[model samples]
Target chain A: MKCPKVLLLAAGLTIFASVDSVAGDVKVIANASVKADTISAADLKRVFLEEKSSLDGSHVEPLLEKEGRAHEAFLQEYLGMSEDDLQSYYQTLLFTGRGFMPKVLGSDAEVVAYVARTQGAIGYVSSAASAEGVKTLAIGVPSSNAERKLITRVEPDYPDTLKRLNIGGTVRLRVSISAKGNVEDVELLGGNPILGESAAAAVKKWVYAAGRSRTIAEVSILFDGR
Target chain B: MSTSVTDKLRVGAQLYDRNLGQLGQYHPSLDWAVADYRFKSWFGVRGGKVKTTLGLYNDTQDLDFLRTFALLPQSVYPTDLRDATIAHLGGDVYGSLSLKHRLGGLAYTAYAGHRSDSIYGGVAYLAAQYQVYFSSYGGLQYGGDLRWNTPLKGLLIGISRMNEDVTGKAKAINPLNPGAGFVPYSAISKADWADQFYGEYTAGKLRIDSEYRRFVHDEQDQTADIVLVEIYDDVRGWYVSGSYRVTKRLALGYYYSRYSVTSVAGGLLAPYAPHQTDTSLPANHVYDKVISARVDLRRCWNVKVEGHFMNGYEYSSYPNGFYPQVNPQGFKPNTNALVVKTGFNF
Candidate 1:
């Protein structure tokens, strides 16, 4: 091939690789117990952000990834806010001393480490990542019956510090609850380190007694300093 | 300092029914009221307002064997040491001056406040201090606060230090009198003291705080130096914070600290007393780490809950007596706390 043609082919191949990466689905994971049952998409949102403090009466903690492509996808798909909007919301919270974002880890390995070490921790990873310590939470389609069930029983608020500080704004998270009512694991779908703890602490104490196995839920925090 | 004539003042009162008398004495619920006045830069006063409280104040946290009496969750309380307990039934005075003229870009404020508590005591507190705040980013941001009391921010990192310091008489039995030695001891009339006198400056996301404090008698003295470096990153709605402390949970939130003290003659007290005492002249080196995480959640009803954890060394001494006494070895107990309070201001 001519040198010019060769250069164009190389450029085309690079573009293809980039497209392949973009099209890949970001995998959200949970503890082994989460896969044992199915949860509604709305419930998944509640679990991660701790809108619902408990499933049943047990408390659980949710986890999430630091800002990245996966985080943005999780937020867009699971949460309704964009990355810039979420950042702005968190900034307001920090100044008011309402609460801090959740702890951020660099990789899925780190997320796994956090979930394994903390009692009620949750996290997400690329489906291709290792599942050494965490389990997978089955996310039911929103329109499905399970999703409907999860929605009706939605927790109205997170039992975390952000709630204490009256922090508002939506964060998407994945949660794992144990039979004993403890948040077994967590994964951040979207949010910062400061506001993350409030969600995580509340989730760890959540209880979901009537679920078909363990469940995952998503939620949002709306701050009104009144 | 010059005094300005201002009769009308902002006033508020708090009344509590002490159903469970924490003092172990059958006492009724107490009532306290505070009224403060502000001058419009007439005379030497150039600030917005001066605040002062006058009423019966309870210093139960400083009572004899206070650690044993404190109803705090075990997580927040440290080793049980007996410190002097003084409840001021007199006055709590505060005054601040604004310096918007001196520095055009920053608004400087200087304040001095005093609280005198006396409970079955000869003398309680004559605490006094001077502090300034620079509103560098206009009035939207604040950067400095210096005071003789605990740091007063609503967050854990600010208020965790000296959370409980009841200024009064010592509770140790007199080592000289064997028979008079088993009861809570009282301080010599002139031995009352104050601590945590520090200056702090913060601009944007950084804060520098330092203090050199002393507890003294007419002839003897005990002193300490504390310094802290905190770099706060503000991310709009949420914050990520880390700090290094020179003291235990007493200084700030999740403070990893090391402390040293020098004393010619000073005693350790309980609850708020330093855990370590240096009697041989004036020097000791102590070091430790503090890990703190704080979150302020504003939900329905304006509720604020703060949690703090400190794993490090504290210097506590009950230099006065042995009765209402505390053990120094058990003085610096590991401290953890979760405080939930509902508050509002207009």
Candidate 2:
């Protein structure tokens, strides 16, 4: 008749997103004290979910933006859970003694400032936000046995009208590569359907190193107003 | 429910419904508490009242906000047993070890403690069937659990073992033979033990889990007449469940649970037959099939509706909510129940 008390560790690393875009496409930001320039999407989700406290030998903590397009974008592009689901999930972790609540800051500026001041803080911000004091960390494939194999990078185009009206967020596209290292196909997974079309068009020009077999990669692009 | 005392130390406690018996009103008491310190992931210590790590969902069972079902599989985690089953007074050594490479990680907890059962719980209700009333029941307990977060994503397996030495004191009055007066006795179990095995798998929005457990108890009642009554209870239970998130706000779940107890009485324990063993008695088993749905009502709240189809709870030596004494009208072989529950967490 006892409630089941369990001593359990969080499950293994989660495998997620791939980094293929560059420059103004930056979206994830980490404190300068963090050692890793690029973090696997799996580890990003782990840290944000409070599954693991350190990444690449550096102790790190995750911060959340209270709400907005950036917050929704981060949840969709990385954690893959709704705001309520995330909160309920956190409550599970808390009651189980598996995790503690990470600080939540309102707006991208608050997150940026907090991350800049906190030595091991990591958070997501708008692509339009200035990456002045914090370091932008690229999300990569942790399951791959090799480093980045891309030979050509194509930047997604942001429609002027959408950018001017501040209607900007993250767009995800599934990119297929042939065994011969040529781009084969691109399909929109999410984001504004129109922005998805432009993101897909740009991703189609991407080139990867030849592999033993055709490789499928998920690519995320940011169309920022700035 | 929890607060940080320092960067490395945290403490918390819970007090809730605590209805010890059917006739007992809701009594609030400190259910569980702990002062825990995590020096490292692989090494930590906790003191005060610690929840035992048994099977799959024991510790988290009290927190309804985190589950899709209105009630867990009662064949194993019975809601009536919550009084003393939730925690023990003592300390624990625990940690999560990250294994090298693809082997994944292992988490473990080992502890020794004192268990104190409530006088107003199942013990009292079960005794009422035999005309005995207990003032207290408790003793020493120890257990541990080891789990492997397998290399395969979303797969986890674990085993747990618990042992206890319990003693209870009570007074019995013969209902028919009023002249017998009140007789005091003590029930002692030197070694009672339980073992459990469980596994859980998660893929996308769907989750599946299963567990099996066995408990053995041999107790002896000693009265001032020097008469000894031997009581043996062999309990077994198992359950398998699956739940899928059908939408952002809704989830569906179903589970089947089987529970049974074969009891033996000897040396006057059974008034009609001194040394009788009834292994296949109808009162000894309960099987259940359940279906449930949950809606995420808000950021910090959820509501669950569940249906239970239960068979064979004619009566029990443990009196787990089904007692012949309580149902003078007799019991139906099969019964169904609908439950709706909403909980908040913030």
Candidate 3:
């Protein structure tokens, strides 16, 4: 009986260790000169994809680790692409003359070093890696926790015809929250246009937590006809 | 060379091979050398030699690595007139407007300038079209393009318009007297206006592209004393293409293209009969069906094999001039050819 319990504990410990190793944390780091301390995942993807070159009104550059655990995680989690697909995507951009290949380093140490010396450079590294000279950025959750809290909630009314037909989708919106927590504006980013209209109207009526200045937030609302 | 002076200011010079291994000397020339300043996401100004935004693929036709097919549909991007349609020397105003929410985006470009004629290719193509030997001087070219990237991923719709005024000197040879020197035939001027509409949809591994184009060419032939021929030629072309990405390294594509030119007086000629003296023969229309398979050998290299089944002949020739024997009864013939091409880019 004791031997069986010992075996069970050993198995539990091994599973925990494997989980820890596979779910290793990643940290987004930037040069010391960068003004922003937090970034949204969508913005991070956009920056790395070369869709936008500026962040919070400051010019910025994105660096990639050549190959490693952190590199794989960044590509999979943030960019939603495999390494090969990412390379092909970059090649397409280069051939189209829309963008250039970003600087790539071999290791986390090299990435950290490059980001430290280069102003406005952004990169990702393993959370355990030493980031002595760079600033680490926190991923912002637009509509939850410490970032912004929903005080007043307004549910969008599903269209009657759409409900009857079982038409449903997720509508993404960019909401502007004023310093006083009032919803200032809402713009539809994507979804069925008709559904987007109702979503925007409901988002405009919602209230957020007060902050020092206006903050832009991305939120998604799903309608499943229920 | 491209340098980003600031977050919103960029200057660059783009150069591309003039012939893409299809014609004479392989020389690289400037496609666009420009300074662009962006005031906002919706507005920008660019000045210099700019890529003419005349068609769906014209702006990036030279970028072989970005295209799936080894060769673009020749009915629209005819291999011979590449230089004339590549870029224009002047300024342009371009911008992108993000539609409400993330519904989609609309990009637009408008420009005006003169295009330099390639002595070997562009001039030759023009000469063949008018059925006379000619030396060309480049002319004014201007156009605008608007593309809407729909909310549906990988779907795009666009429309473009272009106008060109080309001028050249034509000379005719007397076929009956083979030994005599050529005579000054007419000073030819051609005004070509074209419009095109295109749509592309890409979903996962499947891709579809289609385009329709129409061109109107008005020509005036004149000597020092009198005008000889004044006519309008209408040409229409369209293509439907689809591709499937079978794997990470391989893709297959097929396309059907058709080109037709209206029977015009300039394209007609008198029959050999003594009683017949009016322009009567009609020019032939052309059709091409192509199938292609491409394999990416590595990150930087790709090879493509393509087969083209072609029908019809382009049968416009000078009056009383030498005619080729391919079309004996004025009926177009069918031909087939295979092409293999590889591309490497860094």
Clashes of each: 122, 7, 4
What does candidate 2's lDDT look like per residue over B183-276, in tens digits? 8867788799989999999887888999998888878877775555677778888999999989978999999988888777777546653332
- Per-residue lDDT tens digits of candidate 1, residues B14-78? 33322221221233322334333433211122122122110111122211111111122111111
Candidate 1 chain A minimal-lDDT segment of 10 residues: A11-20
Residue pairs in collision within model 3 = A188-B101, A188-B102, A189-B101, A189-B102
Q: What is the TM-score of chain A alone in each candidate?
A: 0.45, 0.66, 0.54
For every model in order, the fraction of real contacts preserved is 0.00, 0.22, 0.09
Best by TM-score: 2
Best-matching candidate per lDDT: 2
| Candidate 2 global CA lDDT score | 0.73
The candidate 2 chain B region of ten consecutive residues with least summed lDDT is: B272-281
In model 1, which regions exceed 4 Å deviation?
A1-226, B1-8, B15-32, B41-186, B189-258, B266-288, B300-316, B319-346
Q: Which whole-number lDDT from 0 to 100 does residue B33 have in model 2?
A: 80
lDDT of 3 at B35: 74
**Candidates 1 and 3: which is better by DockQ?**
3
Model 3, span B268-337: residue lDDT tens: 2223212212222223455789999989998689999999887765444211111243234544466676
TM-score of chain B of each: 0.39, 0.92, 0.83
